[model samples]
Target chain A: MLPMSDLGRALCIITGASRGFGRTIAKEFSRVVRPGSAFVLVARSGGDLRSLQAELTETEAGRAGLQIRCVEADLGLAEGLERVTKAAQEVATDLTEHVLLVNNAGSLGDISRFTKSFTDMTEVNSYLSVNVSSFLCLTAQILQAFPQRPGLRRTVINISSLCAVKPFSSWVLYCSGKAARDMVFRVLAAEEPDLRVLNYAPGPLDTDMQLEARSKSGDVQLRKSFSEMFSQGQLLSCEESCVKLMKLLMEDSFTSGAHVDFYDI
Target chain B: MLPMSDLGRALCIITGASRGFGRTIAKEFSRVVRPGSAFVLVARSGGDLRSLQAELTETEAGRAGLQIRCVEADLGLAEGLERVTKAAQEVATDLTEHVLLVNNAGSLGDISRFTKSFTDMTEVNSYLSVNVSSFLCLTAQILQAFPQRPGLRRTVINISSLCAVKPFSSWVLYCSGKAARDMVFRVLAAEEPDLRVLNYAPGPLDTDMQLEARSKSGDVQLRKSFSEMFSQGQLLSCEESCVKLMKLLMEDSFTSGAHVDFYDI
Candidate 1:
């Protein structure tokens, strides 16, 4: 692992940076990363990402030459992936000392039992494209763009979930997509020992995904379980989860290729 | 479990039935299934399935009123899925006593180390589409097409692999796709108890896939390992694997939702 000082010159590329854990993590990184650090924020909503850029730029670290670039593109499409890849590469050229990737964008798609065929082909395709294929493409692009730069700290943190390991009642697509994402990172970690790859499961955080799960109509049991979890204050706040994640990211004790949970930390 | 006599009137739908284990399984079914039974064969190559149909029709089972329908369409595309679904439904209309769906189609999708940027978006999409989404869609359609008819045994056998549980260096897409397939069947088994879902891992078979793996260019270690396995005569022949699979399919002792291996039986 590179020294913490090298992080000052790190080029961090984060997907789904407009909201939820993505936004929270961006804020945490902005506060913690030193001057000369650059961030390339990617998401579907240009307005949301622009607003985030404004917020980050107003911070003290931003004033200290922390660069912020927003690339508004849907990760579900090939064109969007190309755009993000170009943006990431351009930003990396400016800050080549260290590179970090956060594949955080994901979709729950239609969360329903197999009996309920609510999810169409397009939705399923988008889910796999965004969650698995796109992530793999971007990671590959980044790895290729920076080919063994001496003293450069290369790290990838895939935001996975409990669904990766456990099979849910009505979350077949989501569970599988996340599981694939984790496996991709696991394989990458094995193939590239110099690169740090972590499949980080943030646990059940209070986010839009929770709201979506609670509101699903097809699976009554699933909705009830989510509602109960909400009522019992079982869901961790995004702020708390981001703090723990940031801590984990900064620590050198965490082994590469490890699938870690926030609760475990 | 349904009685063996029910197999006489069973409507078995097999995907990737043109070659390899699928073709062997189709042959096995042709020999065992009594007259009045129907087989719906789906694959990209129409000619191959037609030849198989002709061969089966020459046998005693075919002469005894066994109906064979070949659906020449790719399981990776929506149009192909629609065509196959329609064909299966049409075949089911005539032989609706017992419906068995065999999701045997899959793609390795440019198997290479994660460090090697060999797999493109198209290949990745095809892998997920063919292995996971298509399988899910077909399963869902079959379940809907033949809803819980009393005395109508509904069984879904998903052809999975050991890669589903173990992560390999160059088999990221294949591993994840098979894992997703297994999880889909697992979920279906839970949601639809009336349906028997089996995630069957045939082990390493002496099929085209093994040959392809042995000849892979990106990973020497992976290729060498597969070659060693082949030289050691560890890979099971397609005929041998199909025999074991047929026995398991006919057995009443095997429970629904069981992920079975050929050696275990």
Candidate 2:
């Protein structure tokens, strides 16, 4: 794991951490953060988040009172984004400092059929709403609430996917949605140089979504062909990627919010 | 001008056509469309559009009774999208085959300031409403009402900007919004191969918005820089770009709505 030296005093808000990468990110931050730093956990599953929060409190990096605030709300809709933004702002106001916003929450819809017919309009619409629209809303809200403050060194890390750069037949919606998010950060970083914005593509890993996609019922032939991609047993654990990400986050020399791949490390 | 062959046998609906490229596009299509085709123009300026409809009828493209229907409504809001969609459906019903959806209406807010402190939140928010969110909503509604017929080809052409691929320092919000629209087309094309969903980045054109931006008062350095960019004659004319675009649309070889740039052709 990258040593968390500079993060001791940083304030972070991570979304979609109920399980998978979000959970790993929060726990890792808790372990590395300085004694006075704050970490906020956001997701839809309150119960799972509470358990994860408790687990975070036990880590050595968690000693900073590691103020953990769990706000359970769906990040898929406009209302959900507003609720989280309000809650996050309250935390920001209490600390009197801008935050390191981690736009990590997302959805991985069924990948079995690849392209569903118009009859699947509901699914396609939902995918666009949650995976793409919500990110834009959340970004706008955060930027509007937190204006630039001197010496704050605020940052926004938009978690994207390798699938965004390469076209995946089955993940048409998900891949393109992430690509949209990637562009959001890219444009924002160029507009505001002071604010560090990173569009990250965490390569394929052992996440719940991947596991589910691998086993989805569909054309046995198609599934068999796709499954071979993950069968190489090279999937990175969330912890490994989180550690690498933290390393990048702590480094003062890196460009702000470039679309980076974990495998590149 | 690319001849609008067989367009008279069908219907085409375009949003945001009161002025700018939208007005030019509607007129261009009206010229080449089959005398029997219908062209529905949607924008906020009803008075201007009504006048335009009459002028269009004087052309040969209109001699064959090419219907011109104008719907004046704000398309940035959800209600507006629904209203426009309903109007579009009414026009589509009159057609024998299907409808071609052109999401050409867009805006680029003033970019005279580099610092967010001097930025106008209302303007940025408005840009998102029109350029980003509403594109998806309109596309969804169109897909819902889209006529499904065997061996029939339907297309959704999204007019994007060169700002989508490359970032301009002061145009973050506009760039992000345009990029998001392109991403939607990317996903839509992949999911529905039958529907010709395309995202084309029409290069910088001499539009009223650009002129307004050039005349804005703000950070002297930034504003002067932008003014120079315009003064140097770096922008393309709307008619020139439209002619190029018409070539692509009529070529009929661009099967999927992949992101195409004018220079590429």
Candidate 3:
């Protein structure tokens, strides 16, 4: 089990760290993580990552010698996945006290109403590639790179969604991808008992993803639900969601192979 | 709901129809389907499909004027998907009474022990492409091409597996792909009430897939289970399983969007 003290020295790798929950989670880690710990942030936007790095450096945690490395790469592409894997390996040289891999990146991939036909094959391919394939590749690489040692804690947190278990009208790609993600982690959990794996559904968050869903002109009911959720203040802020997630991550009582929801936490 | 009599003139599209369950299912379909009904057989082995076509042509069903068209295409590739989609469209032009799409093609991928790392990205991609993406693409195309008409039945039969709901150690790709396939049909069912979608799980059939699983050197427990099942005559033959499936397909009582198992029937 990973104790709060061990988190300071842990090698944490987070994908989609440029913004949204990824960014919030990264920031949360910075606040709690020890100075010896290194953060490897992966995202497509290099500029945003750089800005984040600069921002973190100016913060109290950065002043205390918190290490941060940014890898500008899209998880949707093979080259991007390769880059993330390479960066993680390079960053985790001898500092493998506890390794935490956060698979937070996802793609909705041309959301359309269920009444309409699906998008082109390329768009569908991108959805699976980015959400499912990339997660598998990265998780596989991490598992291979970090063998379970006696005292070393390894935790894989897959940022899944309620859509994974529940079907939504215009969210087929997201739903299926997240479901696949959950199963992947479940399989890994069963195979590697000593390793900690969590499929965490963050629930409705005030993220760009929600904004994108609101922007869609498809399905009136779906749109109305999103709008209603937002207006009712039901969507949790990224910080709020991250706080609960971080709390759960730190707790040894949280069982591995569990599909944990934000509400449950 | 389609009566057994309507099966004769329905346009049937079967993927991976060259051999194994696909081939047997195609043959089973020939026996039941009426005269003037067209069969689009999709597989990588053109030679095998041609032989099946010739063999079927000699049968009473073929002599009765049941049309058979062999589309020798791999569902793992885009071109193959296009070819299959095009064939389905062409065949369904005049015969729009009923259209049946059987997504039977699947790949177990490069199977290995749970302890070992996964196969390369290429092999993994093939599994998702063939098992999930192609299924989605073809279903989408068929749904778009053949709109539901009053008194006409449009049925999509995804030959899923128990592995879809149950996770297997070495069968990660197959399990996840099948799960995704099931969810795809579920979403479709909810959206298109006029269309019938059946995620049929044919339990442990005596097909080449079983032979392949039995041939694996990894995971002693998995191997033992397969060997025991085979030796004990626990695995259903392709013919037996197909019969049950055919009955379910023809039955109006069979609920759409249900994850049906052979035993359940």
Lowest-sum lDDT 10-residue window in model 2 chain A: A113-122
Candidate 1 vs candidate 2: which has greater TM-score? 1
Q: For every model shown, what is its TM-score relative to the native structure?
A: 0.93, 0.81, 0.94
| Ranked candidates, highest DockQ first | 1, 3, 2
What lDDT tens digits, residue by residue, belong to model 1 across residues B17-134? 9999899888888887756788999999889999999998888888887878899997777888777778777776544577888989887867755544833677687778878888
TM-score of chain B of each: 0.93, 0.87, 0.94
Better of 2 and 3 by TM-score: 3
The alpha-carbon RMSD over the true interface for every model, in angstroms, is 2.2, 5.5, 2.1
For model 2, what is the C-alpha lDDT against the true structure?
0.70
Alpha carbon deviation, residue A228, candidate 3 (Å): 0.5
Candidate 1 chain B, which ten residues in sequence have the lowest lDDT sum?
A: B112-121
Those runs of model 2 whose alpha carbons end farther than 4 Å from true positions after fitting are: A1-6, A63-65, A73-99, A108-152, A166-176, A211-234, A251-253, B1-8, B77-98, B109-129, B143-151, B216-222
| lDDT by residue for model 2 (A1-265), tens | 2333666466787889898998888887776556667777889999998998888878776544667788888776566777777776766543444367888888766666543332233455566567655666676677777777764657788888876665555555566567667776776676777787888777776888777767872436545654786787767789889888888877745577577889876
- The DockQ of predicted model 2 stands at 0.21
Worst 10 residues of 3 chain B by lDDT: B114-123
Considering every candidate listed, which one attains the maximal TM-score? 3
